[model samples]
Target: MVIPVLAIVFTLYFFSTILNSPWTAQVSAFSLGSLLLLFCVIFVAKTVYQLRRGDGTLSFGNIVSRDDLASGRVGLFLATLGFTLLIDYLGFTLTTFLFLLVSMTILARGRGFMRITLVSALMALGGWAVFILAFDTRFPRGWFETTMKAVLANG
Candidate 1:
């Protein structure tokens, strides 16, 4: 159920992007639609497999474990939503770093503040260097727009 739900969500999101893009007029919408449809198919296949394994009597409750609900995984989903809101403003590296740090500490129960700090910093720097710096990727930057423009321009 979770996998199918995520697939549907991601499919909608990708479809949205294709719709919003300036090249939508030039590109074939069918291609994008078909690709997303593939995910839907995969979701159905997995769901059917689960149903068969359950002797045609599937329980939705069993899919998501009680321990998962009790843990801070629910909060992680909320954090993912929040991270998406912040991504445009903070840029991918900073936003991903912050999200990962919060997720690891809260949900994963990772110890050692120093380790988290180090890991987050390294991940942000590496992501920035590789994606934004080396590859010259152009991710949206709401607040850091000017700074990103300058750095990317220099590169």
Candidate 2:
């Protein structure tokens, strides 16, 4: 309730601040903001409905349990936080690959390597190709991708 309300308020403020931006930037920001707003609206409505039906309380009673904080949850949360901070080093494609692989591995206790590999490859390459082909925006290629490109170009 509170979080979504804040998100909705901040999103509107952000949209106001970006109204003068060019279409390319505005389109991306507008789309993302609209999506976020839509989700927030849905969440708010659901929360209200639950409250009316006496299904759940607004209180976040023990939501962040100590056991969860002490468990692998913390590791998972830290991994996600670090992934965002270090993504530019590996670029979107490779960073996404490693993030999905390691996150899924941790969640599933090391099972589903084949599934994870397939999904991660599809996401990374598909994202790269989409940006390169569609948007004409080749994202930051890390050292590994840069080297491969140079090698391929010379060969």
Candidate 3:
């Protein structure tokens, strides 16, 4: 319920921020945000209905338990935080690769190191190819992107 409320608030705020942008820029944001807001509203309504019917209680007891801690949730959260913080400096591809590697390691309980590394590398490269190379998005450029651009331009 709390998550849905927060999502609703944030989606509205996101919509507000994009109002002054061009329609092209606003199109994707508006579409995605509207869907998020709709789902959040539905969730909130369902939770409220359940509460009114005496099927639920407004308790935070189950929100964060020992099981959640043991399940690597904290580690995954930290990895995400690190991705955001380092993206500007490390650039999209490298930061995404590192984030995925760390997150997969945490979720896999440190097993399958080779497979995780390969998948992370492949995913990072795929993202670079699609979003950076093909779409030419405004993501920050690091050594790999810079080198790739130079190689492509020369070749």
Candidate 4:
């Protein structure tokens, strides 16, 4: 319930910030934020309904139990945090690739190393192509983007 409420608030705040942005930026932000806000509203409403009917109890214990820590939740959280912190320094594509690789590795319990690496690389490249190349988003430029820009310019 708290998480959903926070999500709603964040989505609204994000929408407010994007008002003066370009149409492409506004469209993408609104599309994703609206869905987040809608889902959060629905979840909060359902939780309230369940509470009123005495069908469910709010338990914060399950949110951070030992099983959750053992199940790679902590690793995923750290990976997400790292992604946010490192994105500016490393740029979007490279940071995204590293984050995905680490996240997939954690989720797979260290299995499928080769496949995870390949998928991560492909996804990072695809994101670069779409967001950086097609949309020309303001993602920070690093080695990969710089090199690609040079190659494309020369070619």
Alpha-carbon local distance difference test for all models: 0.73, 0.79, 0.91, 0.92
Candidate 3 residue lDDT tens string, 16-47: 88899999989999999989988888888898
lDDT of 2 by residue, 41-95 (tens): 9998998899999998876445556666545576678779878987779877788
**Weakest ten-residue segment in model 2 by summed lDDT:** 60-69
TM-score of each: 0.53, 0.50, 0.62, 0.62
- The residue pairs that clash in candidate 3, if any, are none
Candidate with better TM-score, 1 vs 4: 4
Clashes of each: 0, 0, 0, 0
In model 1, what is the error at residue 64, expressed in angstroms?
A: 3.5
**Best-fitting candidate, scored by lDDT:** 4
> Model 4, 36-117: lDDT tens per residue?
9888888988999999999999877767888777899999999999999998888899999999999999989999999999
Q: How far is candidate 2 from the true structure (C-alpha RMSD, Å)?
A: 8.6
lDDT of 2 at 91: 76
Lowest lDDT sum, 10 consecutive residues, model 4, at 60-69
User: What is the overall TM-score of model 4 with all chains considered together?
Assistant: 0.62
Q: List the residue pairs that clash in candidate 4.
A: none
lDDT tens per residue, model 1, 1-155: 56666867776677776665677552676576677678788878877997888846556666567766668777788889989998987878778888888876776566776788788878877887787667877865444446776877899
